[model samples]
Target: MTLQSDQKEFRSWLGTCRFSKPADNGETVFGSQAVPTECKAVVAIWADSEEQYLNVLSLRMERYGYGIIQVDDIMPAPAWMVLKARNRTGPVLARQVSAEFPFALDLIENNPISQDDNVGDDKTLKVIVTTTLHRVEPLDAQFGVFPRKTLPEALTEWFFGPATPNIFANRADTGNTDDNPSRLYAVLDAGKIPNLGELLSSSGLEYQCLFNGKTASELAEVAPYLVKLEDNNSFTRQLFSRGKEPWFLWDRAGGIFIRTAATLTELRKHLRKFTRINRGKNDWVYFRFWDGPVLNALLRGMKSKPSHVATFTQCPKTLTFITIDPLTDTANRFIIDQKRLAGAKKQPVTPAALIDTVQLETETQVSTEKRLIIEAHREALFTAPGPDDASMELLKNEIPFLKTCGISKTQYLHDVLVFLIRNDLTGGKLSPEQRDILMHKRNNAPTKIRQLEKTVSA
Candidate 1:
């Protein structure tokens, strides 16, 4: 049938259909006006010619919103084609005209129209439309498909699915093992822990050996003086007095512990010192909790589940490390208080932050020098010399002129070498000693530039 005839038949069928319309606007036909705010609606336009259908669809989408209708030529037909045709068919076609107001699942079951539903008087076109009183989940106008899973699984899949690469595999080796493990995992919050590995990978922090646990006797057998529990807690003090080292009481089956000469006190002291010297108050301090269950899950490549690590926060005045006794699962906490040593106040900002500023100044100086050199040697540098002897004489004369231009010997040599190389001036180039000097200057250009930057900054 013609496109005009098909459209007229569809409109006639639409007029007879009982569906809710916006009370204010009198647009009864689909794609006639702006989609009603009261309900999410999709209109499927069909014609014998794909071009005609698409043309109408584009016009409607442009007039309305792009996503108002749930059809795109890029998408697969069967995934969204709710109605199907069977056996012999002529130019006549049937398109399902269902009002899935705020899209729902039982649409087919609750739909009043059937495949057998008749279109009055029009044999060439049939539009079987059904309107449901009940509202389904809100339709994503852009993507009409409703989520098949529950909210949590949907959210989990959305976040850690194929898009986010598994980053737990990138963790720095902590020498953890079944026998002589070198790390402990502690669970902080189960919910916020899933993306901790990604967070750490992006933070650009250098990995350091932070803590170690070993029996006092075992430590004594190796280096006893290095292992000391300097925790201010009374319980820890009492445990130490009783010669109860943390590793001695460790339950092999319950929790993992590392055996090393490194002490927690040393780690804390190092961090405190580093922060005092390098980090400002505005800089962030990150924390990671290594709990057994969460660690196992991460190692097993299960990123969808919650991780044991906590989110990084601003550095606190004091950091509390909690150790769970494997035997009783009771917590033994030790606080690392940030000590304000005498000369640890904020100092004058250094040149490290001014690297960009110094770089800009260096670039400007180099540009100015290049301009001066180009102007001074425009004729000798650019023009072809009379002969080999004349070119050699010109190069020899320019050497003194180059040095007097306030350019460093290294820079002068570099510029001269570049000019010679570009101009093919090397018939039997400089002597080995001169070549070596040029090579040295070329290699040390970066260092020279750095020194120049320092001088300028100072």
Candidate 2:
């Protein structure tokens, strides 16, 4: 299908979306819009590293409103085709899984150009990513697909800060172990429920059981119903709901898995995690947790979870060479708070209130300069709205040419005098001779104005 069709189908599958109001009755201040749950299918990839793949997976999954659960000893397949397979009978169908990415090359090439553009396009550059998904044996426990070079370290650092590389790297190293030690896997929510049993059973391969629980075998029974290969390059994971229900897809032994109480909640939870891969800050890994059963399932299922070492240290150290603006400073402060909440080592938290106060004081100094400019303009107005006879009564009734010029402030008074002399305005205000002199200076400036002023005054 075309992008339009894809989007349309996606929205239908996603269900009616809803957003939370500001400061809604939730622990978190910002409200979130609900993501559609009825995924058509899910895509998975066997990327090179969990860290790098997370970023990539986050992009793809987030696009379709999917989430990711870290699976131990299981690597996610790259590019699970979320859409239906067009024609399985075709010979090409045997080699690849899904349709080739529409603009893979154009996308990759245009990335740098977009980044340098600095306008809105530059922001897209950060969001667009390359993920390496693998078409590998289902039973094999050791494999990764994301190309290392595709991981843009500099770009990640620039957009997310220092911690991002390590977070990516850390995620990459997640699934590996001693024997079948390193299993790499991540899941995508297609937002449409598909026949998981038919998809898996038709793959012509035995389901690889990776999770360990009382219902492990029973869970495997439904694995096929929950997943499908759209083509060689992609596969989809699906879960449909009757009403409020919980759906789970996890490793058979004990590894990364995701479960949602409600189909919609599951999809939203998965999408939240899925899209978060690219949400890494300038240098740190900061992920928000999904409330409810998804969180409980992850805590219960995973044998071991990832840590945030890279996250804590990713912050930019006090710089001797660089200066941070308020925006960057706000981010830094937020990172500090996030790390603290994540149970990382504590750091000095510069209260935002303090920062606000400092900013206010500094702004006052800047505002003073502006005030002076306004005052100077006001003084200049005295020339146009001439001084009243009440003040001019002392000096001759002649208007001061400098004041009459309507240039405000004492500074411009000197400039106007010189301006008059430069034009050979040698006549004084009262005498025609002086008036002529003044007129001479009026049409001249710099040299003649200064010289004539001196000659007349002498």
Candidate 3:
């Protein structure tokens, strides 16, 4: 394509551009024969601005599978007057050109220039213009709003002007692409006695309670707003449905949802007391019991005319719970011992020091049996013959017991060589030939194992 200074023209040569459309049976039909004349153009322009260029390019490439036109070469206007004239009018012409045209620019800044060309008095600029028509496929009717620029007409009027247009003057704003905020829900349970409302107010923990006597079906209506606490366990559901005892619910970080049949009275009496006693302490206490049966026992104990009395107590330093396990058919008791900071203090160690201590402990804890097995393998490999057929056969036979004991061939060979060199098994008695063979086998064990695998697979 050719663009010049004096005249408002751009010329382009498009050779054999391919176009495709899906047939009724979903097969793609290509070339000028399948497309209409008006739908086709010698040079197609898809965008004028960068945003438009990106939108059009994305649509053509991703949606319609169309390839953008690529420029082969750019030639500058020869004379200084011609260069100035073309630069003045190039940007205006560029906006009118279709993106499918090799010479089209999303913005005038995209116009090509010859690096060797100069506007100085000593150097002359040279312009080359080529225009050719190849098969033209119809442009999609959906994209007809964009105008097409004739390559020859755009290129011919070129003698004297500027080379590139100033692009920032007419730039369009593209807004920020931040994502929308996510919806959040609070967990709650239906309750009555020591009511959820009264409990929430007393406990000072943030919570939202659903209405009492709300059925599972009614709860389902607000499912999106209700964060669930129970998984496969249906005890909480039963308490919400049948029991008059108050139930509590709360959302915990890391997706831990809490639901219990313990009343605000029992919660304040037991769980909350634990939190309060440990408050401001450098240590914390955690429960080591199941929830379902414990809550069942507590609720059963709280009945107005209860058959069995469930006694609960919390010490300033400890909390205890006694309950029955229906699955095991036995009574269980658990204690939450208070944890407190020690009065004695010591200097804190750096991470490097901690790592060194751990590594030393690990090294000291290596099993004696493992050490003996490695030593045995090392002695066998060190004393074995050279790489002769008979020697290899004998060496292989020596490791059958080791293999059955779960040592890998490569690991066995590696341990054998390492132990031999360490003077742990061979006591540094290895001859030059034995030492060389053992080292060679250890180094090449991986390759040897691969060959063995291939042989076994074959």
Candidate 4:
């Protein structure tokens, strides 16, 4: 049995570029003609663009009944699975195998990972800045290295000519690659954009166009929009201190790279007042807040073009609602809505509503009172049979000796004791001698009422 089990586990190989579906019975995989006998698991690594990698990993885990866990920089040995090969025309064998993370490369690097610095202080601003550059006209372009100090020559030309000299100089000044500046517009979406006008004016940075390629001046135009603070915990401290928000670190199949998402500070501030926030294991973030008030305010905002307005004279107290959306899908559509205190003001909309509100009283107290009365009646039935003449008749009937011993029935009270004495001497079984001795014992028995009472009490 053990050998057969080993063969079953080791029958298939590690999947490479493709995956196989589970069998019709949904117990295990069936198509293994293409699988190698010695393989157990497959591993793959992707570049920094995580969008494609995340989808592939999620699919493989679901199809193979395997779990997804983080692995280290150094990958596993590719050829370590040959011990499970099966013997043909023989009993089956199964072997157990699993994925592993070796100790050497599994440890995370020591380089500092940035975290949020915002706390009780709310004045700091963090912004997602997007800049749009337009050319006076079109021109040809080429890539060349520029000196670090030159106004435009030192800057890397993102787009070639066919653009106006003024606009080309502006795009070159900031190292911007997009020729169509209208397509790239920046906004203060999540973080604080503190005193935007001041930052732009103080640095003399031109939002329209810059003749001199000044990276610092352009950053100054963008800086007021970013959350400002002096803490080391700030995520953009290195970016802010070095004056390089627009520098390209590297390039991949997609394009140039920079970190420009909503800062953790902005996200927390937006979601803090919400009643619930769900961070699911599938890498999604959802929020639920008081919806009734927000919806009415939104309606008012729609009605008034340039200013805030009121949609209703007074707010209702009963209705409450919330929403949920995934983090990756930022287009703001809710996956679920939980409503509380719903339709409280409606007047019997359905028959079921009326039934739910009906009140009924309990009958337990009344039933308990009737049970006690029945018990009292049962006690009255046993009171009539007193222990006197009836008791004397019953004793004589059971013993049968007093009537034959020539004792009067009135004297049965005395004869009862005499019967008891003879029965005890015969060990509760009557003998011929005990019957003859009964008369002798009867004369010796207690005769007076007071003496019989004393003997009975003893």
Worst lDDT run of 10 residues, candidate 3, spans: 248-257
Overall local distance difference test of candidate 2: 0.26
Candidate 1 deviant stretches above 4 angstroms? 1-22, 30-42, 45-75, 81-199, 202-458
- As for lDDT, the candidate ahead, 1 or 2, is 1
C-alpha lDDT of candidate 4 relative to the true structure: 0.24
List where candidate 2 sits over 4 angstroms from the true fold: 1-164, 167-184, 187-194, 204-207, 210-232, 236-293, 296-458
In candidate 2, what are the lDDT values of residues 1-458, reduced to their tens digit?
01333422221111011111112322221113222222111222223333433354445444433333222211222122221233222222223222242101001011112234334211111111122222211111113843312112322222223232211122222231211101112232222224444444555423332223553355544321112112122122211101222232211111112211223323333233222233224333212122212222222221111122212122222100011111011101111111211322332222221112244344543333333333333344433222233332322222255445343344544454333334333234334554454456344434334555566687
TM-score for each predicted model, relative to the true structure: 0.15, 0.17, 0.15, 0.17
State the lDDT of candidate 3 residue by residue for 1-458, as single tens digits.
22234233433212112222222323222222223211222222332222233233334433333322222112221221232343444334334444244333222222122344323321111111111111111112222533432111221111011211111111122121111101111233232122333433454343432222453346433211123222222322222221223231211001111222233333333332222112123343322112323233332322211111111222222222323221112222222211110111212222221123243334322222333333444454563212333433434443443344344555555454344334422333445544444445344544433544343355
TM-score result, candidate 4: 0.17
Which runs in model 4 stand beyond 4 Å of their true positions? 1-49, 65-197, 200-458
Better of 2 and 4 by lDDT: 2
lDDT values, one for every candidate: 0.28, 0.26, 0.28, 0.24
Q: How far does residue 205 in candidate 3 sit from its true spot (Å)?
A: 30
lDDT per residue for candidate 1 within 311-366, as digits (tens), equals 11002222223333222222222211112111122223222221123443455444
lDDT of candidate 4 over 344-364, digit per residue (tens): 122221222211112101122
